[model samples]
Target: MTSSDTYQGLAVTTPVSLMFGRFSDAATPLLYARTLKELLAQSGLQKDDVDGLAVSSFSLDPDPAIALSRSLGLSLRWFQDVNLGGASGGIALNRAARAVAAGDADIVACIAADNNLETGFQDLVRDFSVASRDGVYPYGAGGPTSVFALLTKQYMQETGATREDFAALCAGQRENAKTVPHAVFNEPLSPEEYLASRMIAEPLCLYDCVMPVSGAEAFLVMSEERAQALGLSYARVLSSIEAHNTHGDEASPLSGGWATGRDRLFANAGLGPDDIDIIQTYDDYPAVSILQLEELGFLPSGKGASQLATSTHWQQKHNTSGGQLSCGQAGAAGGYLGLVEAIRQLTGQAGAWQRANVRHALVSGYGMVVYDRCLATCATILAAQESL
Candidate 1:
């Protein structure tokens, strides 16, 4: 692979989140429309002002980006349909930044929304990809829980991580969720309670899985000068990187593409892990979070559990928004959750759980598990405008 590239004079602002409970009768288009409306209102822009759009969803079947644009009555100069699952947020932000930098569009909205119908999730996973439809689902390995179960098990065995390590991660996020009004599982989760939660798959318990809900998360991308003219709080994109299927032939993979791109990710940003004040990792599962931390150079590979257990580094610096574990994963919106929260914290919009003097934040995304391993991995670092 090549070295990473940096984003210049691009500002990410106007974060919006509309997360319904475990289920929402609202259609995917309606969710997107609502999110866009909020985004426009927050940015003080008209529908005509947004000249670009980027969207990600799993249930927008028979409806591509063009269809959504038509439905939303948007006349866009540019558009992107992102399908990177949990990695969509960073990818969308990266692509939208490039679009604005290249003068393709003046203002871009990056949004991800989805609905949780009774059977929608099942249908999504069963036919997610050729690997799942033809190879994995026919035998009864229907969803990601089982696949991640095996991954978590192998990670535990290899890294000497225990259920307690995962429990700490979940419980801490739950505590953080308490201050987040939109979090679905805000009740304080103790380690004892996490351990006692029923088992969904061997080594994967109930609390370890993300609750699928229907909702949308969105943010606006524009030039730094435009943001200043609008008098808006914003975060500057330092550097972003993405890699897919980096493991190649490793079927039961225990790692992700972050390892392949992390050095350049930090190097291009001119900041090391210690410089980051907060980190928002895609927490589809605790073990996956651990892997991301290790791969991102937060901790040594095999020492994840020990370092996490013994130190407050992760406890203080990680997932200040409670993550998908507590907030409920709204399909592709799970990808945008961390990004939105990072923008919030950086922009001084994060209410109670906001950290003081958060100069920089790191957000990572992992998603699209076809069968054994997640295929998409992406990360972006953002700095508060004042810090720049």
Candidate 2:
């Protein structure tokens, strides 16, 4: 089936729960359990009501999605284990929505979690991919930071982007972080401070890297009828698209696969970029987020840097949760951060940092950095319940 043809009438509604902050005692399964408990409490859903399960985690090794059902004592009729990293949330939602639409499951609980032990991150980066283990790590590439620094340098040279341009975006996100109680970086930040921060990798400073933390995020997917019956407010998925390995052959990649299906994505949603009230892009690095904006039709390709530098549009409506930059990247849960935040803003649950009239939101994910660039790309447009 085509990407747009997978789930025509399914909607993600109700009871989105997120648990942030660094957890020293939590394991992967425990995080999943806590999130599920909160989700059930928020939605008033009994354990038996969840017939489908979708999970994404970096530390759930040895145990998979099916294992979680047993550990959580859930009798699921459908299950999925999403390992797409940053793209896992979008992919899990797409799959769970399709299952609900197909009558294979009544309600699907999608979750992502991980524990950040002392050596967990290092171990993950080392084994992220064959290319990294055999090629990049041997030279002390310093994991994702090094890989993205090269891309940032090339992006700057190609677009004439100055350090100030990147710093401005970071500073704006920090400002947004001040309102998010769970954000790890809540202190006031200025472009001057961003420019002066210690550089981890050339062109990528400490602010540019996502801090590793242990946490989980979860949301539920069901039919619109079910959500209404439960008297729950939900976000409707107007359109979604996923692509992988689009530019695998391109050396030193500049764009992701979002460009491949952007036209169809907006067409399927019957909405354009201008209609979106807010945007959330996978922000392992600011450069990647800018690339997503360009490739997803918000800005002209290769022009994101200049537009971001001159425009204040993003400062007000983009990544309102301060994104992973301020919240800390919680393993696979990083992928779900934007999705959960979008749901909160749309459902009137984003108390302090909520947008005024968030009728529609654009959320994008890019992940699975192999050798040169991220191989997976996914995006979804969500509409408020009132709009539906």
Candidate 3:
């Protein structure tokens, strides 16, 4: 079905980022608490003011939203525990926006945080799902590297994209990372350096894989009237769409649900790709980002590499926060990174990397790799209030 302006009168504000590191001694709960504290502080809201909370995390197993609410001392009228991995941020925004718009909650806080323990990543992936435990682990393919490697290989064969193409993407993001104070890998990366980087899986090198880090990202969703009464800087949610298990039958999937909902996404937003001033994609890997760029109508299918050279340029219009590629994937926080960055840009909070007159922004998410391919894909368009 097509969509209309379902997200009218919503204000997404108070983007907060915290505790980015290769490892954090703190537990997942502490990370979540710290993030929540900052989210409230930045929004000038008391703890009790937030009656709605949505959380996403891979390490917060056993302790779900109910347990977290008790720990945070929150008596909420609305709550959600998102499990969509990299797509959690957009999904959280989608749900929380509707909640506030429908008066189910006055102000909803969307938060994703994770701790980067010594063996956190490996442990999390070793038994990620039934497909991973049975189909993948038995054959020693315990993590996403092998799966992405296979997809990268197929994507290359189909699109005629080379390592140099992916290198351009990575190299450009490293440049973008320089402007982000919290980014982990801001070191300069040349295409040659990317090509020379050690190969982790066939066709997928060390540089192509995301570095697991500890971090949290959060934002508040409420009505425009509420945001104005608080005198807060906010962005209007123009449109958003999410889907899962698209192209599930393909032996080697190259795309996801983004394409199926692309037309409706733009139509609902009342804008096209050309109207976007900034783009933040879930860059767990360059190739994955490329596919999103293609499927979302930024570039044509099998032609993503062509845009990498220009899109990844310093201070250019793509993955402006350096993405999870250079920013370091902070568990489920990787999903929220783009959303936070987009909100920051729209609110004039992005310091060095802020683009001029960033009236429109696009954020896309892809994640939940089960066995063969990732199942979830989501995208959202946000507009500066003045642009409305």
Candidate 4:
């Protein structure tokens, strides 16, 4: 990992993502500036050192890249505004990483954020569907909550997956969330609790869905050479894949774009399922995780729940940051946030939730398809410095 500056070392000097940064009480101009300033100061990088920007968020509008650059006095060499839904952060990092590695840009900044707590449900519905074309929204699809519910219903019939099984899946996530400090729903919950929660949509109780959480998670990424020059602990960006399920609802029904994409991503990384020590599966709905795991060869098809119910393999604690259900799904940045966690786990910096000797990790991203579904899945293989 530390041979020379001329080589692409296995260590990361620039960030792929930030973890457990925060949920601001409010998104004031001061608060926004403070968040950026804090991260820059935290990393000890000066304003001029920042030369590029990319961002993904649902609530972070009003030209985030420009405003953030202006706030930090950064002269951005390249900038990107990502709107890939749950796949946003992942896409952004992949973009920035490739850009930096190719010498197209250096000192790239990737940010994902949200400022919703007590955010109106109606507003969320309207805003979420905006990603869809007008023709697609009129079906009253609502959001992923409703979309996943229908999928869960169909899945329940196919696998004889009782509502209890789904509850258990989410309940495990909630329990894992208990260990993640920044997870929005960090409180402990039992299966009874998940089942008892009000139904936002059939087969999807309130607990199964992601909530609006406010926080800005930002990463300062520089080329591997610059990172060595600065002396930062980092992981290597091994490989990545992004797949879009352009067929909308029907696509999710037939395939795990998320799951299938993971298969291809790992193949590209030339590592198989066991090679991944820890994982962060985008769980917009719990079934997505089950379906994706099966597709990625981590679990057999139609037996994901059975495997999850009995597996020792994942006992190392996947998504200890509570996945999306616990981790605030910053819509656009949700995917990247998962990628950031892979980085943290690899670097052994994930506090309280740290696992033993995490080297390689898997992270997945799901994007909006339509009618309350996101079959678009992407994955990345990340390795700790030593592993690389």
lDDT of each: 0.88, 0.85, 0.86, 0.66
Candidate 1: list runs displaced more than 4 Å.
Answer: 1-6, 331-333
Predicted structure 1: lDDT: 0.88
Q: Name the better of 1 and 4 by lDDT.
A: 1
lDDT of candidate 1 over 1-388, digit per residue (tens): 2222436788999989888778877889999899999998899988999999999998888777579998899999999988888899999999999899889999999999999998878878888889888877787653888888888999988878999988888888888889898899899999899899999987999999998899889999999999999988999998899999999687669879898989888988889998999999999888888888899998898778767766565776788879999899875849999999999999999999888899999999998988778889999999999986
Clashing pairs in 1: none
Score candidate 2 by lDDT. Answer: 0.85
Q: Please write out the lDDT profile of model 4 over residues 253-325, one tens digit for every residue.
A: 7365655455557666668888888888777777777876777778778877766755445634567567777
Between which residue pairs do clashes occur in model 3? none
Q: Best by lDDT, which number?
A: 1
Between candidates 1 and 2, the one scoring higher on TM-score is 1
- For candidate 2, lDDT tens digit of each residue in 2-53? 5445655566865344544565456789888888898899888999999999
Q: Compute each candidate's TM-score over C-alphas.
A: 0.97, 0.96, 0.97, 0.86
lDDT score at residue 208, model 4, on the 0-100 scale: 76
Count of clashing residue pairs in every prediction? 0, 0, 0, 7
Candidate 2 residue 25 Cα shift, in angstroms, is: 3.9
lDDT of 3 at 25: 72
For TM-score, candidate 2 versus 4, the one ahead is 2
